[model samples]
Target: MHIKEGGITSPRIEPRFEQLESSLKPQIAPADASWKRATLTRQPRFNNVVARNWRGELPLWVSYWVIGFIGNLLIGIIPVAVDGTLSGHGYDPRILLITLAGGWLAIAAVSVWQGVGVWRSADARIIARKDLGRAAPWAILAKLAVFVGLVRLIALAVNIGAPQMTELSRMAFFDDPDISPYALRIMRNGTELEISGGFKFGLNEDLVRLLRAAPKVRIVHLDSTGGRIGEAVTVYNTIQERKLITYVSHQCMSACTVAFVGGQQRWLYSRAQLGFHAPTFPGISAGELADATEEQREIFSAVGIDRSFVDKALSTPNNSIWLPPEDELLRSRVITNVSDGSNFAASGFGANLPRDTLAAQLKKSLAALSDLERVAPDEFNSLVDDFLEGYQKGQTEAHLLAQGRQRFLRIISTNLPLADDPTLIDFGKLMIDQYTFLNQRDPSLCYQYAAKGELDPFLLSPTLREREAALDQRVLQTAAKRPTIPAQILQSLWGKVISAVTLRVGRDNAHMILGTKVSPAQYGSYCEATIAFYQEIIRLREPEAAELMRQVLAPK
Candidate 1:
């Protein structure tokens, strides 16, 4: 408690009061010697203590960098964890935003705490005071750099791993049901089977199982908006292998058209729509996309569709659907028939009659007519003469048959009158045979009938008609002695003649004709002959025949 000043001694005093008085006393030193004097007098050990303390704590820039990096890392990881927890469970997007914001605010609070620590640190305060504002700005910049670098690292990691993680999360949290999109139902009293809806992965297996269970199915009706191409190809192969007829009464798009093109006999309703497009897969690699495209092209080519059609389908972008016009459908031979739904309910094989019994009756009637043609040639000739005379006056084979049918029915009613009598069948066969013979004897008769717009070509079953058409084309191409009429013109005339007959007799009546189903080949033979004869008359420059041919050949 003694005081000494300027090399002189002071008197001693009470220790506690003297200590307080000494603590309040002030001392001054030269500016050059201030640091040394303070270091020596104000406890020189304090500098070492402060240095040791600051050594345990980090430098301000280092501390800020570490804090910012950790804060940003927490900000990144928290959101990712929250996202994984709630992913694929249909959580609102705002939940993720809120979680990220909360984490960022926490990081910012930590940064502010770190800044306060730097402001309070004895060494940092002294250094900051000496360096003016440079120290704080440099520390802030270092922290900002560390924060940005950590955030970018998190973003890179997330970008690289998000897809796989998302897929795994979805599988774990939102597994889908294993239900098929397609449904198969037997229709038209089990003669036809209707397949509806999208073509899912396992639809082909379902379709094949249904088909195996229903062996009687001859027609497959399609109603779909398309789906997996692999399943569609399987269905197409099954349908083609079975030789089943395919009918589209509604929308058939994308892969659905693949199955449609595989039909043994394809048919379309007037209002039905069929669309096509190239295959596509999102998020697939370039090589994988190329492979898929090639596979699709192969499938289309294997179906034997026109190359142009295949090209159009392939060239169309995957996002868009190409619905070709009806004329293109017909020209491409994509459909063998176009229906208006009128015959759909009743046009299946033998839908309107007992098939086996009708076949037997028709065979018997055909035999009886042949016997009559041989045994009573004179009576047959007289009946034919009367038919021809009636036909010439009425200008229609149906009219001629109607006039002769009553007389023939009256003649047979007395001899073989029974509830199941074959009289009508026999009479119809006789009328058809008479017409066939007359057409053969006079090549001009077809022209005359065609001129009057009354050419009545016989109807044939789809199978028989397609076969005959193929044979006709082959014969035309390879025949050593070609007909005077070109093959194209002959085909054109044949199509017109058949169309006219179809319009005249009505589709239902034409389908109901026993000859059409029972003896389709024979019916087709007569039609081909009639077409040839009509073409010959047209070549000979008959004005009425030429005019009628022009009208028939014009685009419908």
Candidate 2:
């Protein structure tokens, strides 16, 4: 119906019901019209734009999640785990950790960059609403991955900042074989157990048994170049458990240091040294080596060594060693105190060995005997055999030394060429008589002569010639006037003879014979007095000494 207007005679205007009705009815478009709309005339769908952008970015997303993050993580963690699991070993590959840390930073940058790109380009809400129905789980996974990546970054920080912590954690998973002990020279003196030699397999058990049998043992003396780490550990445990002191009078190296640190009180004599180096197992992987090295590193650390020092020690190659100065060792807490081992007796064969065994032992132990053996093997062997016989028949070291001296002097006499000349014979006889007389007073003087090479035939031969020529001149002159000569004349003649005999023998030798040091200023007068006394004895005892006197003073 139309509303009435003010103008009369106007046709009744009504609302156009037909146009409204037709507009409301569904209108079908031409097929070509729809095709034209889709292909050429349509505005862009914002949701579809997002889906396309995301599809284009799929490669980077795959790289970030699959290759960069997950791949790198597996590369770092899997080997450590697998090696530790399969071989019961672990190691810190510093180079590998550094490389992985670099990769983590790179991947983290890519992840952030790619995320901002997606945020700026794609409408994630629209994309999910339209097409992500089946991929809803992937969206949740992305959130979880972000959280995991954050956790990994934190761990990487810990690895870089506190490497020792990481190393300790890695070491905890391994259960390595214990180092077995090797045989060594072990000696017991009172309450001390002295161990000397390389530590090898079987030492632990041996030491354990020794300690068991000797519970009163209070000190463990170690002289070693190291050996089995396990054996050292055994000693360390024993020392710690017993609350015993550890002493080093000579040298303790490598694994020996491990045992030494276990002592409640560690001792290193002034001349002694402690050596250290990284632990090694033959044919082990680098990772395993690091694990083994960590064992000692932790041990040293527990004993209050500086971390840097331990690191350097463990980093050193096993083929070489680190012998820290005694002062440095004390500063580093490697030892508790400086000791000279004065309160303790030095290690030696304290057992009462059989005669033959003692002789062999002395032969090997004495430098003088070794020298004699080198110079005269047969004489040395015969002397040693005689020593054995005498010792079996009860002879002391001093007595044996005396007998050896006598035999040595006899050897020099037998080898001398004195029999061809009467003058040479007399000179030789004089030396023998002098030695025999002095030896009756102090047998050690004979040993001193042998030791000092004072009776060396080669050295004495020229001197004897000089003495012989002097004696020949004096004896001829004395023989011309002696038998009926005045007392002063006889005394003067004998003085000249004695001077020739004692001249090359020297005042030092004369004092040595007397076993006292006469002053240099008084040496000449003292020597003359000694010579005069011996001369009178010779003159009174033997007419053979005065045969020249008898033969020449007679008138035919």
Candidate 3:
């Protein structure tokens, strides 16, 4: 089998055309038949119009449009053919096109079906299933074709079908227990979660169902204008698992308010309202129980808030809790954003005001209120009486009130085993109450007049006046940071009033003392707090004397 120089080594060659010619010997050709040329074409695996388009046969879209248009043309011509008339826009163009294409495809499909039927019926040529080799390649090819057709389907029906399924999921905040619809997907953005429909029964169950269905969902509570306490608690439990954020777009009252406070992120709107009173069950009664007892910090942490933010929220009540502007909410981690609404900012009348502003205003107003309580004796007493009346109602009116004032008093009286550190003033709350009653009855008695030297009339060991004076004295001592002479001069007195410093009394009378200083805002800054007097003598910080202040303020 080795090839030498020019010798030809050949393999066998046979004429394969003769075998097919021998097999078709019975078929006769007509004398006039010109030998027809035959060619093999590769029919595409995917034949449907949309399917072909999906397989990169994008021209089919134009074809579909054209065919639909032609179909519409046919429909439009129908009236002309039948009654010599034309159709207008009233005719559905889409339906006409689909109908026409469908009819054409149906006819073509029938022709192919009949030919296949004739081939299968030929007795001698009927191929056995096994002989066709366990389902032809064409069968697998058909499955692939069907898949392509399904994915590439462009009919209005298929497009229309999808949105109907998605509509249910779009409403994540909405709850409806009456019907078992799909749950929505959501997250805790600084975004608002608004619920459209009003409240209905079984809302708690609906919310529970939602959480169970989508455990990973982040939380957002929009304007929940109060709701069932029991239901709110259940919803809160669901939210606590992830420490989900809860928001009150404006007002979250009663049960909902409790839930908001429990949130990892607490929020308030500029226009938001927070109503008091305990959380309650709807249509059911329970023993009188307080709403929330633990400190604000613990509640926030238990619900997943980072601890640092809880500190700020609790510390600044009106700022972070009540009238917290949106910016502070973000800084304090109470809320992430305003989402969409009038931002949380203070306004005139001061109802919806910023925290710092509120604090300053409160200090001024309270100072005034305290003075009015002393000066216009009757008017001041009535004002205090009004405060006490409101305080009493707020603490006792509702069965489920937090009752801070009462609880504080109880702790002071040692009637309550818990709450070791009650506010210091609780010991004389009764005395204050008596004063309130007297003021309400008479309205014009000065506090000293009301006391009328009976300050300790009960034969108590220490006289009431003596006790009051002792407390007042202690207060004054605490209020003074340094002795009247000034801290720098405390050790050098040598038992004598110095001649270098004159001990002269000011015009504020020999009794009263005052301090004054330059403005804080100007370049030459100072304030009244820097100057003071002690023991009827005018005393001032040497460095900030009148001449020095004049120089600091001069044309600065």
Candidate 4:
């Protein structure tokens, strides 16, 4: 409808229509240009499945950023907090199982919804980039998140579905016991309460009840390898409140020390041990572990342990143990005194325990040394006192054994001024052999003999008597067979047997009767001579006849 020319056509047109066309043309051109610009700037419609349900751009964006990220994080944190609270207080197993089930279910539902929303939102962004040819930096990151989310979902499902697999994973990571085999005992006829083994859950409650029952228990003996810190802390509070003295018999390790240091007067047996190391828990963050370690530091510090020593103890790795010597323990004030293990019943080889516990075994091994007290009372007492110190300094039983042997040798040497090392060694060996034989035969015999200060060989089953009885029985049996040797030669061989056997027996008996009065050097010489004499007899006689005599007269 353009007015062609300012000639005949323009003169005939209506003035109003011409005026309207001119005015509308200017507005139309601007509106078309503005529409094109807006189209290019606008975001594309979401292309994934969630777009069908969501129906608008705002819903998709809100679900992706708000519900997917923030909401999921909140959900994840709730369960962890709940679990920590429940576990820390030693809640029932069933309650924990129920919490895990509900928490996982809520997490799973929300996570699936979030994944779908995120998928549609990311698709829209990718589409917008393709249509407009503009950069979409979030597209790559969203794609990576989608893949990772799927992997995490699969892992979560599998882990939650299989309890054994979850437990295995936990064990591999934490390396801790699920349940401790802890024990509690009323020892010393109700005067002592012994807490042994691990410091398991509910052990503190056990302590409270036991203390209530045994009002006479003024001492708490700790012998443990460690367990739950929560249990240990509770037990510590109980001990402190009761004003009970704490003692370690065999070992007080890790969490056990927490309770041990709570004593009104902390003490450890001379040979007892206190082991330390950092605490461990599975699935805890570095920050949480640091906090837990700080708690342990505070616990020891509260009890007046040296700060440097506490640092050393807590810095030790969970897999390893740091056992400080008794002097260090005393210097750090970790113990009030080092005991000789006399006050506690665990020092004795009491009922309902294995023979391998070092304290009990040490007591048993040292019991035989009482025999030496009869001959050298001053030396014996000094020797035992030194051994107690050595034991406190962390010496092994074998080390103590060697130390005792050397001390015994010195004592014998001092008594026999002319005796040499070889002679003293022979005397030592004889004493050891006889004591071992007698102890093995009947432990009561030596114990009673030593207790009564009776050195009468006639009352005891001497080694010589057993050997002679064996020889006589063996000889009588051989004589009954009427061997086909000439009577004169047989009689001669029998006499030699008598002489050799008597020489060995007499030498052994004399040493026992007059220890340090007779020369120890003579016993070994006589034994060697007896063996040589038999060899000579064997060489001169017929092989078969010589074998019979050899069997009867061989040195035991």
Candidate 5:
């Protein structure tokens, strides 16, 4: 099969097949083999490098999916659920919402950083460059969209589970009976102790301990809806003993009011509220109720509170709280100061009135009363004895007299008869004057004054006085037939007269008496003299005759 081009015959045509077969087999050069070997060596190593790079970024990708999406979703949902569950349990929802928003932002920021890091990696950049025309923008956006959608789905799941989660958490955390609702703090450098929440049994002990630990603590800031009458009473006694100040910046209600009244100096913020209601002993027997009523009356009475305030508190049903008006609070002396968290000391009652100044003022008041000589000798003497006793006990004469006057008025008012007759009004005025003289010759009692059509002894006309005398005879005659009438009905009628007289005297001469320049001891003596005079007059008149005279003063 070999053809010779020259004249020489080809050597061995039979063996040409071998040479042809050899030529047909492929032949490799050294350079070409070297190039193939080099390519094979580089390809696998390049793949390995790419795989390592991806592995390095795997954690970031995992984080984006788990923490960014799932974790964030849970964070947002947890608070929402918790807040929902605690809706009425005193948690603020806005706090939860803020927490959720913060969590989401933190997660989103981390996810974006990680995703960008992956996109900027060497392998990723190479791939992106190669796919620039085919899948650059849309593919990246689609991936991001998928991630975002997953995150949204997680959020949706959280929302769906929120209600149930909230309920579960609430039951777990809030409904536990062992947890106390009260919060106590020693604040303002331990000069103030704040008590918040319901008054529990241990509160009194806690307060005592706090007071002992920080003897400098002069202020007890009360914010309570009130609780346990017995505990409140204990607190009140402690406060009174320590002569501590009580302050209400928010709410003081029910038994809390009792504590507030016990303060040596009581203060209330403009926005603060003091609520009162009749004492309640749920499921108690009638006997218990009666006892409770008496106890409450005694508490207010001890504080020099008027019958009106007591009546208002007692009339309010247990379930309802009576929030007295600011004016009422001021007038009742329940809150001696209304402050705005500044200058409390300066604004407080008697804060500006030095003891010496008060004593001087009281003396002047007594001197004026002594000049009148209107009170009976015996009553005046008794008043003097009481004043001296109080003074010896380190109580200021003015304070003693004020307390006595307030107590006397309260007693008379509580027992006063409800009558519309002018003669009764006149008689009431005379009785009030006599009582005022007996307590402390408040010169105001000598002045004529009546409110709401009631008789004011100080303001009574001679004709009215005569008529009152006539009514007294009639009352005595009636009382002879029914002895109980003198103690119950006639006594009340006499009490009304006493109340009217004292109210007028106090109203007209309060400033004069309280701010007088006389010495306290002298003022006390005058008060005693006036009281003694009134006492003698009553003794001379006899109870039935006095009561009869009171009735005679009532208008027909």
Candidate 6:
């Protein structure tokens, strides 16, 4: 090496990679306070490079949606690929190998390019959004997460630690030679989560395990006849913290429904039964019972879930435990989607519709009435108030039909959020519009929304272009991992009363029901009955009916 300063010039030779590392041998900082020191720090993957790189370039909302797409493609690859293979529709091994390798190379390329820019910049040090002291830290952490996500995904594929395919059937006992709480695969949709064990579990059990594991996992695979309350509490805490999807593709039972409450997104299935019964127990001292209730209350409070839901879950056991009907679960945040025999499972939590249909119909119906101006909002209100005035009332049909246009006016004014936009009187309308032409044309959304309609590919597509973001330089320097895909498909068709979105419908008012999964005409009729019933319940302030109604609302 030679130096060239100002006027002096000399010959020079570049140092090789080995020479540089060997000579610099820059020692990492010594252990700080308590333990051994390290050259680099560790962090949650989300807070790493990608998140640190958040900027003014993209809107926050856009970033949220885009991140999900990117995460699905990059992070969800292993499961998607595995699912495809098992489903008998995946690419051949050679091509698949290339596909994964290419993904790595692509991510590397992005990191390299972004790293160069960062290296050349004035504020080069990165850090994650949550732990930002410098840009350098953000870059390092984000890159690491992407890298970790990829590597973890690949390793999962390599570990097919399940029993032989010939080992079990639907009625087979739990006898798989291999077993693991970690799911072998969770599909692109929410239908199934295949653990390393050949013996299948229900939605609640898997969810509880995933939640307890915390930051290590983002999603859960739940399969259960629906087990204990304590486990449900654990699962609920996890879902609420991570804002994950809660599922019930196979069978979601009693205590399982407790954890289901924590889910921000809830999903269910066709032939997918959700059952609940009162909490079963042997005799206990009064003091023990009080202590148990307090314990239960604490669990719910910690998870930010409603204890009233616990009351409802416990209400189902009159003669014996019962699964609350899907309709009943609608009252709480627990379930997002419900379907009949529909095999779509990769959907996180609920197989929510892009839009609501009944709401739209109600809006349109109201509009037609508004045009006629047959009666004003006040007259309709008077009629509704009178109907609700009953501990029991007259034949609603003649009174309702006679009310005519006023009936719609009352429903729209009271139940809908459409302040100025009469056209938007029903939120369900928006959800319904989301249905693709295929879903709309499907004859079964009425038989049950849960059992029919196709899911959009965007929701299920596995593509990881976002992992190659400029800040993921660490990913450029490292490896990849894969995950197990759930056996359930990402696309779904729901049966009547199974489409949970109906619960959020305008239904002429706020109290949603489980009945929208029925046919459209029936949906309207059911909504009428539900609203009427609730109207009375709300108006009369009936505390007496609360306990009984809770049981009736329980899943059967």
Q: Which candidate is the best by TM-score?
A: 4
Q: Tens digits of per-residue lDDT for model 6 on 299-327?
A: 54454545677666555543566555666
Q: Of 3 and 6, which scores higher on TM-score?
A: 6
Best model per lDDT:
4
What's the ranking of the predictions by lDDT, best on top?
4, 2, 5, 1, 6, 3
In order, candidate lDDTs are 0.51, 0.53, 0.34, 0.58, 0.52, 0.37
Judge candidate 5 at residue 33 and give its lDDT.
Answer: 79
* Residues 255-285 of candidate 1: C-alpha lDDT, one tens digit per residue: 8888888898888876678898887643333
Where's the lowest-lDDT run of ten residues in candidate 2?
1-10
**RMSD list, candidates in order:** 23.8, 22.2, 24.8, 19.0, 25.7, 32.1
Clashing residue pairs, backbone N/CA/C < 3 A, model 2: 180-201, 181-200, 181-201, 181-202, 181-203, 182-200, 182-201, 182-203
Which regions of candidate 3 deviate over 4 angstroms?
A: 1-201, 211-216, 267-271, 280-287, 291-556
- Can you write out model 4's per-residue Cα lDDT over 455-510, one digit (the tens) per residue? 33433355644543333223322222232456676677766755655565664542
Can you write out model 5's per-residue Cα lDDT over 97-204, one digit (the tens) per residue?
Answer: 344344444444433443343334423433544544333443354345445544654553354334323533443455423323555666555677777777655678
Point out the worst 10-residue segment of candidate 5 by lDDT: 1-10
Off by over 4 Å in 4: 1-58, 76-110, 123-141, 149-180, 347-351, 354-556
Q: Tell me how candidate 3 scores on lDDT.
A: 0.34
For candidate 1, the lDDT comes to 0.51
In angstroms, the error of model 4 at 287 is 2.1
lDDT of 2: 0.53
| Model 4 alpha-carbon miss at residue 214, Å | 1.2
Taking all chains together, the TM-score of candidate 1 against the true structure is 0.34
Model 2, range 411-477, lDDT digits (tens) per residue?
4334232222343336435655544444544444434442243442223345554553354333332
